[model samples]
Target: MDKFDKKILTALHENARISYAELARRVNLSAPAVADRVEKLEHAGVITGYHARINPAKIGYPIQGLIELTVKHQDYYIVMEQLGTMPEILECFSVTGTSGLLLKVAVHSMPDLQALIARLMQYGDTKTSIVIDVPVPLRMPEVVETE
Candidate 1:
């Protein structure tokens, strides 16, 4: 939106729990104005949801990976359904190229990972890659002002 809105968003992205007064100060607006902007932003779907970043390893999910699936046919909805029911699948994406679906998975042990892969293989061929380390952890994208 405007520069003030962008500033508010940048401040909130850094800390969602920031007080309205503090946000107002950062954006050079009154607290009420800042609150109104935040409300509008939420209503407009610019701010969808807030979340806490957790350590998967510390939470007993030592294994994290991406599974690239190349399905047998076009009707892959069944596979998508099954993937939705699986707690191990954190995120799924439909990308172009060879892979029909890409899944982000988290599991506790090697046995669990093997079982997940076996279940997935029933749909079609899959390529699994365990995450060794993340150089850039997930972060909020910048809210640049646009025309």
Candidate 2:
């Protein structure tokens, strides 16, 4: 990747919907050149996918929380499969330390969260924490020139 590629990536990270002409202007490249570079980036898997950020509270899921679960060694994959079927689970990660998995969940109410936890406990012990605020929301990695 060259400087122009990095600039194109940085611009796209700021706004994925930017037109090729605008991107070309920002990167000092022709529209066709910018499009070709973006295509190459996509093919190389440097650009995975684009997404829209949503507010759970506005969408009727006001309660948000983190769940730390420590599952038995034999039930790890089974628990992961079950978690995939649960819509309330927004994200799940296989983590280290005492916890085997960490899950980000959103629900309509405390009762909903309670029910989800009760279901998860069937796998193993769980620690749940309600999220009051998110000071720094998810941000894409900023592309920078390498030495």
**For candidate 1, lDDT tens digit of each residue in 10-54?**
888888889999999888999999999999999999999877777
| Candidate 1 residue-wise lDDT at 123 | 88
lDDT of model number 1: 0.90
Which whole-number lDDT from 0 to 100 does residue 96 have in model 2? 89
In model 2, the runs with Cα more than 4 Å from the true position are 144-147
Note the clash tally of each candidate.
0, 0
- Model 1 stretches astray by more than 4 angstroms: none
Q: What's the CA error at residue 25 for candidate 2, in Å?
A: 1.3
Model 2 score (lDDT):
0.93
How do the residues 4-31 of candidate 2 rate in per-residue lDDT, one tens digit apiece? 9899888888889999999999999999
